[model samples]
Target: MLVLVICLIIFMTFVMEVGSIAFKLTGVEPSNARFQALSALTGTGFTTKDADIITKSKTRKKIAMILMVIGHIGLTVIVVFAVNLPQLISSWQLIIGTILCIVTYLFARNRVFVDKLDNQIESQLVKKLHFKKEPIEEVLLINDEYKVAEVRLETECSLINKSLASLHLTSKGILVLAVKGEDRVILTPKGKDIIRKGDTLTVYGKIKNIEEILCK
Candidate 1:
């Protein structure tokens, strides 16, 4: 019975960790979904600020429901076993089991493990399970090959008064995604968007190319 309890604890930990990953793949942000998953697993209802976040989606809701059931069952079994046969297990078994449980918790919380595991899980789910999720590229655009940067227009720069169309920032391998002026922020600035001195341009593209063109 002691061994069974230990095995159940490990299994519950795994279920919770997997639930966290599933939440992320469903388009929830890492920090947010991780909390949601852990809370759901422990039957602790954290604020419902993102409640609809998990409940609206069929897949996420299913995972959350399973975690809730498993959490209640797991807690009940632990209590029943501890009360009925607390002395049956040796002290060493308790120490080792507790250590393992702690280690598993830390491992699951490590960011590196989360990222690598997410990639592997994402690949398998997409290829074999036909999992449909947002592309990672959409979530994070700045990667090894490209980056986003901000450039503040200097008063002396040649492009001070030019419109975006005339400057051809995109042609130079840089795209101006937004413009931050003294009072307002314009998203997807139009071609006729005038470049004003002191305006900050948020751009995305090859870093070196952007530096050569927009960063001038």
Candidate 2:
């Protein structure tokens, strides 16, 4: 809906230019007007065949810069690209608009996708378990400074048969805040509760020490 509204605004602005807004706004220089309109619509920085002539006025130059930036970022080049690409088959304005839109969107979307992927990888690591303990195996999860971390309970481990009170994890500065099982996370286990094999323990503590407890 937001994209549609913005694209509509751009289309309307383009249509309105046919009625002399170009000449009224920028005088007799048709090329400058065309450049400004294209910059405003696509957010591109390219100047016309006669850029030297338009650059004489400092005030007009500044205005051009402001409109260019607003057209590119505020109006959103990505949404414009997505909108104009399919419409270009029948209209030349849409064809030029779509080309510019695709270029801008590609640049922006790459950054967005990288950030999202980083977050997803972090989330998965925080919820992962260590099946067989090894120094190299410990490197898979994020460092221990992170408050939320996961550790897998092995069947032969001493804590497996003992009650929650018996292990005394707090003595080592670690806290087992939750136990993640097949279907749910147990935040508070009773004193007599015994950990089972394959249980994913969510621990909170210093990173180095957390690794120690998981490997021990």
Candidate 3:
């Protein structure tokens, strides 16, 4: 009984680790990726607006498919084991063992263990795309009418060496909220703040106009 319980715990951890790595490779941020991994492995199907990052991508969809398949298989195996357990043990000790197993399983899912194990596992995986970091939830801080986006600035763009005041981004209905450089973040930057190549610009504006301004 104890051996089976240990096996289940290991299997669950392995599944979540695979899910987390898959999410990171697809360009997801660390915290959100971990949550999505747990959601996927448990087959919770949690309603998440940010889930588009995973569900909308072809590569991420492949990971989600594998998780769903494994989740179903694990459920089936648990059901079969529960049905067959009575034949192996007939005494009241079986019931006590099951109660203890449930308690142990709950303890094994403790957040501290999960977080530590996740961090250790992630340290082994490569974090390659620093420039492609996902935007934080700054969009939610503003009113419903305004939206925020992070645009990665490339060298050789015409906007190089220009300050917000010189470019007059406000004239085009855009507001530069912040600039994230290689080592520091300039928040609510003044008009005199220069826009450097390789900086990430967090701007507020309509989706269409901002898309045109950045995607051009």
Candidate 4:
């Protein structure tokens, strides 16, 4: 029973990681993607707006479905094993489980380890799934004062053909983190980088300022 419990925990962790990466590949922000993946897996905390994001994307919807199914089965098994724990309780098993749990927790908390694992899993998923790599604009509220978002430039956008230096976005307290062109991504885009139509810009700033400048 103890072994089964440990196995289930590991499986669920892997599944959640996969789900998070899958959501990200579908264009969801990293933090939001992880939150949504956890919500779907545990069958909780699905706000109407958040749930709509999942339901609207076919790829995300499929990933959510898989996570939900696996989560239900895994949780059910865990419950059954938990109920039978008293009958099989042993001091040695308890000690071992505790030690294993601590080790797992430490490994998970290690940023380097987590990054390596995430990269490997993401690589495997990309190879197997061949997820569509379209540029998508996603806006997320960070707090009462700040916001972070991806704004896609359109043909009619006023910012098109203008360079970042000319727009003076930084003067308005807006920072452009990256510019996603059709073929590649430019991190920390320079002042000379021009905004082209269909390019996606990841920006961060105060809520009102971002809305005024980029939301249009």
lDDT (10s digit) by residue, model 2, range 1-216: 334444555544533243122222323233345555555445555556334433654434654565556555645654655566565444655565576567646754687764574445434433462112222112123453645555666556556667777878778777777776666668896667777766667677767776666656
As a TM-score, model 3 comes out at: 0.49
- For each candidate, what is the lDDT? 0.73, 0.52, 0.68, 0.83
Model 3 over residues 1-216: C-alpha lDDT tens digits? 434544665687678776876676555554567688778777785686656666667767777778878877876776666666656655565666677678767766799986786666555544532222222223433554567876666565667798889988898888888888888899879988888877778888876666666545
- lDDT score, residue 172, model 4? 98
* Residue pairs of candidate 4 with colliding backbone atoms: none
Q: What is the model-wide C-alpha lDDT for candidate 4? A: 0.83
Q: Could you tell which candidate, 2 or 4, scores higher by lDDT?
A: 4
Candidate 4's C-alpha runs over 4 A off are: 138-163, 166-216
**86-204, model 4: which lDDT tens digit per residue?**
99978888888888889889999999999999888888888887875433534676888987778666576788899999999999999999998878799979999989887788998
Global Cα lDDT for candidate 2: 0.52
Clashing pairs in 1: none
Kindly report which residue pairs in candidate 3 clash with one another.
Answer: none
Candidate 2 pairs with clashing backbones: 144-207
Best by lDDT: 4
**TM-scores, all models, native as reference:** 0.54, 0.33, 0.49, 0.68
Q: Pick the candidate with the highest TM-score.
A: 4
- Prediction-by-prediction clash tally: 0, 1, 0, 0
Kindly give the stretch of ten consecutive residues in candidate 3 with the minimal lDDT sum.
129-138
The global Cα lDDT (0 to 1) of model 3 is 0.68
